[model samples]
Target: MKSFAEIRRIAIARKGEHELAARMPGPPERPLRDLSDDRVLAEFSRRIFQTGLSWKVVDGKWPGFEAAFHRFDIARNAMMSDDDLDAHLRDTGIVRHGAKILSVRDNAIFLGDLARAHGSAARFLADWPATDAMGLYDLLGRCGARLGGMTGPYALRVLGYDGPLLSKSVVAALNMAGALDGAATSKAARVRAQEAFNTWHEESGVPYAVISRTLALAVPD
Candidate 1:
C-alpha cells in the first residue's frame, strides 16, 4: 500500500492545498460528552434512509422525520406499534418506503438492546476501539437492522465519530494499492481493507477518518 504521505501529496496536488484542507474530515467539532443516544439513532436513521435515494430528499424531510419518530427517543420509538409505522407510509411528509420506515422501529429496538447492555448505545460506540473500526462495523451488521454495507461507518462519521468511511473513492485507492479487488463489500475484501487500514494507522498514527479521506483524495474525482 502507498504511504499516507504519498496519498496526501497526491490529494494536495490534485485538489490544491486550500481545497485539500477544506476537504479533510477533521476532528469532531463538538465534544462527545454532549452527544446522546437519541442523536446517534437519528443520524443512523438518516444514513440508512438516504441509501438508494437522493440525500437532498432525505435532508429536506428530516424535520418531518424527527416529528414523526418522536425525535428518535429510543424507548418511545421501540414502543411504536405497527399501526404507527404504517401511518408513515401514507404520510407525504416522509419517505414512504415501507421497509425503510419499519427499519426505524427495528433500529430503535437494536439501540434499546445496546443501551440495556452497555448503559447506552452511545457509550458502546464510544468504548469501541477506533483501531478496530471494522469490528464495530461487523457488530453493527449482526446486531442492527439495515446497518450493514456502509451504513454503520457512515453513521458513526455523521454522528461526529472519527471513524473511517469506506466510500468508493477510498475503495479505489485501496484497489490501486493492491489491498482490495473489485467491490470491497465481500467479507474477504473487507477483511483485507481493514487489515490495510489498521497497518496504516499503526504506521502513521493518523486517525482512521483522516486516513480514509486522504486515500479518497488520492483518487481522481
Candidate 2:
C-alpha cells in the first residue's frame, strides 16, 4: 500500500489534464435574512436534493409536497396529523413513494426539534465534526436519508452547507496531498484518495480550501 504522501503525488500527476471550467454558481455567501424559516430552507434542500432526479418529475409535484407537508413548516411538520398525511398520499402530483416522502417529513421534524434543542439548525450542523469521504458516506447511510452517495455528497459540497461539504475540489486537494491512487476504481479507493490529499495539505501548509478550489478549476466541465 502506498503511503498517503505517495498517493497525493500520484493524484497530482494524474490530475485530469483538461482545463477546469468556471465554478458553478453556488448558494449565496450569507444565509438568507430569515434563515430560521424552515419552510424556505426545506424548499431549498428539496430542490438541491432533486438535482440528479428529473426536474419534470419533481417540479409540478413539488407544490403537492409543499401543500401536503404544511409548506414544510418545521413546527407544523413536527405536529403533522396522520389524517392529513394520508390524504396527501392520494395526491397525484407528488412522488408516490410513501417511505421517501415520509422520510423528508420526518427529517424536517427531526431537524426542527434539533434546532429547538440546539438553538439553531445551522449551529447544530456546524457542531458536527468534518469527516473524510468514507465517514460522510457512513453518516448519511446511518441517517437513512435517500439519494445520498459519493456523487451526491460531492454535489452537496459544491452546493455548500453549514458544515463541511466535500466536493470534487476536495478530491483534487486530496490528490494534491498524495491521498489518492491514480488507479483507484472503487468508492473506497476514492475515499482513500481524499484522505491522502488532505494529509498532504495539512503537512504542506497549503490551505485545503484554496487547494480544493484551485483543483476544482482544473476539472473540465
Candidate 3:
C-alpha cells in the first residue's frame, strides 16, 4: 500500500492546498454524543427517502416530512398507528412510497429498542467505536429497517460519526492500495478494509473520514 503521505501528496497536487483544504470536511460542529435522537432519526429518514430519487426534491419537502412525522420523535414514531401510516401514504406532503414511509416507523422502533438497551439511541450511536465502522454498519443492517448499503453510514456521518463510506472511488482507491483483492463483498474483505483504514488513522492522526476523502481525492474517478 502507498503510505498515506504519498496519497496526501497526490491529492494535494490534484486539487491544490487551498482548494483541498476548503473542500475537505472537518470535525462536525457538534459532537455525536450531543446530538438529539430526533435529529439522528430525521437524517436517517431523509437519506432513506432520498435513495434512488432526487435529493433536491427530498430537501424541498423535508419540512412537510417534519410536520408529517412529528419531527421524527423516536417515541412518537415508534407508536405510529397503522391508520397514521395509511394517512401518510396518501399525504402529498412527503414522498408517498409505502415501503420507505414504513421504514420511518420501523427505524423509530429500532431506535427505541436501542434506547432501552443502551440508555438512548444517541448514546448507542455516539458510543460505538469509530474504528469498527464495519461492525456498526452490520449492526444497523441487522437491527434497523432500510439501513442497508450506504444509508446508515451516510446518516451517521451527518450526525458526526466519523467513518469511511465505501463509495466507488473509495473502493477503487482501496483496491489500488492493496487493502483487499477486490470489492469488499465478503465479511472478511470488509473487515480487512476496516483494518486498513484503522492503520491509516493511527499513522496519520487523521480521522477515518479524512483518510477516506483523501483516498477518493487521490484516485482518478
TM-score (all chains, Cα) for each model: 0.92, 0.60, 0.97
RMSD to the true structure for each prediction, in A, is: 1.7, 5.8, 1.0
Name the regions of candidate 1 deviating beyond 4 angstroms: none
Worst 10 residues of 3 by lDDT: 17-26
Candidate 3's C-alpha lDDT?
0.89
Model 2 residue 100 distance off true place after TM-score fit, in angstroms: 1.3
Q: Where does candidate 1 clash, by residue pair?
A: none
Model 1 C-alpha lDDT per residue in residues 62-135, reported as the tens digit of each score: 99999998999998888878789778888898999888887788889998888898888887787787777888
* TM-score, cand. 1 vs. native: 0.92
Global local distance difference test of model 2: 0.52
**Least accurate 10 contiguous residues by lDDT in model 2:** 16-25
Residues 1-221, model 3: lDDT tens digits? 77788888988988887876787778888988888888889989999999999999999999999999999999999998989989999999999999999899999999888889988788889889988999999999988999989899988888899988888888888888878788886899899989999989989998888898988887886
Stretches of candidate 3 off by over 4 Å are none
Sort order, lDDT high to low: 3, 1, 2
Separately for all candidates shown, the number of backbone clashes (residues 3 or more apart, or on different chains) is 0, 8, 0
